[model samples]
Target: MAKPKKISTLNQSIWPYLSPRHWPTWFGVGIAWLLAHLPWKLQRFLGKQVGRLIHKVSARRRNICLTNLQLCYPTMTQNEREQLTKKHFESMGMGFFEMLISWFFPVEHTAPRVTFSGEALLKETFEQGKGCVIIGGHFSSIDLCGGQMTRFVKVHPIYKLQSNPVLNWIMERQRERTFEKTIERSNMREVVKTLKDNCAVWYAVDQDYGRKASVFAPFFGVNCATIAHIGKVSRITDAPVLLYDYYRTETGYHISLQATPDGFPYLDDVENAVAMNKMMEKLINSKKEQYFWTHRRFKTQINEGDKDPY
Candidate 1:
């Protein structure tokens, strides 16, 4: 009989420093590190498997995805909608692996795989000596896409703090490698200052932030509570607003930047919010599966009588 293989003792030495609660987090990081070294195609294949598993087990999130799909694509048949949801989950899974790749792998490795368009616009905006607000909607490939943007322009990304300290630390470290500065989402003064310094600020405004600083705008024909800060920031800094969006393609990742119309935030807050939503809608329609559908985009109801969709 063959001798039993000895168990690998690689991480055993660090076991003492980790609490029971932290083991899972570290285990996940370990897996992500391994995944990061794999070929992009293979990593994406494994990510699809992971996504399918999550879709099978995560009933709440699965339902939310389905609900969003239903709300957004009302005319589609049930079968078609379900297919899109599955595809979206697969893309989400790939996005997870891509996030690992973005943080751990060198930009040179991905540089060949990405094609950037409209970089001249970014350069032009920078030359103008007023800051630029790069607005984008949440997409599955966002992390990797943002990583690629760093190669073209030094941007200050505004991010929400993760609840997990270890994860947050790791993520911030990774972002610091690319971004000139990382500002907390709540730090409006810092954001304004960054803009005033003629730096690029990357902001994603698709998530639901409730009604306080938000206006009801139509996203996929559904009234969504959209954040109003994009216009406010632009007005305050007197900076130009530009839309930067990305999606995966057969060749590789495709990133594009386009300036918003002159006099954006025209008329009123509602109009500005509507314009932003329209831009998001166009990007989502380009590659529906890559859009971040799992988010509760329509969480906040427009009125008391309006029913919660998720």
Candidate 2:
């Protein structure tokens, strides 16, 4: 692996005053900080409990997850789908602790738990001097997996703005500790500029963003809204796009990196979006229980007659 670059630090002076609405955010952060100091095994155990509790109480999110599973795995029996949903919640529960570990602990402490494969692909792509875009689906262990990647390579991560300013401030501070930079999800100008400068940018391409600024594409055999900007950005920057995915094993975490199909995004925007969804499907299928299914992936419809799955 190439030597990791020095992380550029950002000012962390945006602490907001505690208000009624902000109390939950602050309390959550406080609890996470305390949990970060616990042993990994214990933390994982606690996370499983938390996740199980959430699955019982969070009806709306639970329904969304089950709806997604039903759509994507129509052949599976209801019993099988329900079991998968329960496992997914357990994985998500563990992910909460993983995020705390990623944010509060030093990279040296967490590095031993994660193993990497196919890194040569990333190194070769970086060596080409056109820059690289590392894309992945939204998995439960995403935050900690990205933290592990930062130990080996300098990366700028694209992030959606959090609605809670205090929470976002703290989250960005944690990310700045590892990533070369954190780019706002909507800042395409910076994304292009970073790639043009031969820097790697990490993007998670799976989610529902409504009808506008999306292309109707096949995801899990159903037409769903998919982002079409990746092809346009790749065309602008001429950067090689790579697929990276991480999953939890019985022992620890495993991360894999591979180059995308040759001449990808050479096709039109809709084709590119279709290709992106196909790639995501391949990875998500490998660890179906770890994929983020709480959000409605099939929220947007191609026609007015199509009903909302959520």
Candidate 3:
């Protein structure tokens, strides 16, 4: 008998099937395409329906959101947490259809969907000649921010490839249209090459990390395995680290950008990385409602007797 494969982020068996590179991905694309062809009124209606269905079907996931919210926002009432959770899912549905159409449909259609703030921040960073390390959180409309950022400065998003070949092709094509380039995950050499060429690279750090490769950091009062790559890259390449994110607004979505303290004065120390990660946590914490709390942020726990506060 064959040995069972251990489940890891790398072996997320569902990715091959659910990924944008697969046939199932095309199903989502096809639905989005059809929705795009619909009249605006009908499209909005369909989106709302999809959003309702998403909430209905994701009961367990909703509970997870509630749990995460309760942990993060202990002072808030249950009613408030539930309301935010519902809004997150509703926005998620709208975002899903928007992403589908954005990825497959014409770019012009989705261009008007976002309103950008901190436009000058991006331009100023690019003018400095040094490469930038853009850190994004799992907030609202990340897909839109990725597309919109390309309008100003050059950005190379460090993306993990989808196992589904069909969806991967669609996503790769879409991202390439918006950014200067895309770097596949685990491709350290390519990332280095991009930085050497004086180009900015973007990364989302809201996911788990390997034990040996990460420092335990407190995100919402929980110890999560967080990557120190941004600090390491800054130390090596001296790139300016910028915190960038998008959140839903009454008008539309807004892209907020700000500079993070780079050149961590104590480069040869582990504390520098930990400090940077904590700073990131503060930024994400300030916008608790806009955060992707559904993610299993604390999936990794500190080892026994480890005095880590994260």
Candidate 4:
């Protein structure tokens, strides 16, 4: 038999397709819309089946989830971690399809299925006439949370580019449909300029940033690679930082919005920004299970020659 060709890296092949961002979302939304029209019981049954498929296919990702879960929650038993890991993957699989319809197809069509709580935070921040920084993590239905906020404020989120061109192009287009504007990580200047305009800058600083752009922040008592750009953004723009998270509830999605500085205080310096980021880390740890533990967040191993201190 002939040797099979190896697949190229996603960055090289699929990054281009995601730049436009809307068309692929439209594609996903179309599928989601159809799924929504099905009988309620049937939709749920299909969702569960999809979740199982995700577990089966992403074997490596499941292992990473287990490793992270154990590292973050050393107190939990192995069986407990295994169960939660399965639940996390199942929730994510269903959430992905649900969001496809909610964010892309039509707001009126899908918004009713879920409800938001901290809507006032968005309005209050926008009314202040100063830009605000909304920080969130890679949780289930994170896109839905950001999409809902867009209803009140023109949110410009910094999104990491995807490796698959076709999939990336699809998602970028989908996101643009809801967000006021979209910014990529490669353009640092534009991100700064966006905040300078008094527009909200949404950043998900939950993942690794290698060694250069990262700092060793205490996550579950271990030094985890945390990005410093979020703190930098707050320092540079003097934007009020808010901790935001959206999780799945029995009825729908519940958004938790917390305003720091106790209503209003001077947070105009890098030191203050760093302090605020520490608080964010603690808030994330409070609900460890709800976070996206499957991600290779601590993948960056520190080298001996590295000069940065934790």
Scored by TM-score, the top model is 2
Q: Let me know the TM-score candidate 4 reaches against the reference structure.
A: 0.77
Model 2 scores a TM of 0.92
Report the lDDT tens digits of candidate 2 across residue range 44-72.
88888988999999999899999999999
Native-structure RMSD, model 4? 6.4
What tens digits encode model 4's per-residue C-alpha lDDT throughout 1-310? 8553332232354544345664676576467667756654465557667877888898888888888877777899999988888777777776666665554464555455556556677667767666888776777667666676666556788877665445455567677677767887767787778777878777776777677777666666556667666656666676777776666665556666667666332333334434544665676565555577778866765554544221
Q: Which has the better lDDT: candidate 1, or candidate 3?
A: 1
Local accuracy by lDDT, each model: 0.84, 0.84, 0.68, 0.66
**Candidates 1 and 4 compared by lDDT, better number:** 1
Per-prediction TM-score, please?
Answer: 0.91, 0.92, 0.81, 0.77
Candidate structures ordered by TM-score, highest first: 2, 1, 3, 4
Tell me the spans in candidate 1 whose CA falls farther than 4 Å from its real position: 1-21, 304-307
Query: Which sections of candidate 3 miss by over 4 Å?
Result: 1-28, 38-45, 262-287, 304-310
lDDT of 1 by residue, 231-269 (tens): 788888888888998998876798888988778856488
Candidate 3 residue lDDT tens string, 13-122: 44454644455656766776777676645655566677668778988778777877776678899999988887777666666655665675555665676766677777
**What lDDT score goes with residue 59 in model 3?**
80
How far is each candidate from the true structure, as Cα RMSD in Å?
7.7, 6.1, 5.3, 6.4
Which of candidates 3 and 4 is the stronger one according to TM-score? 3
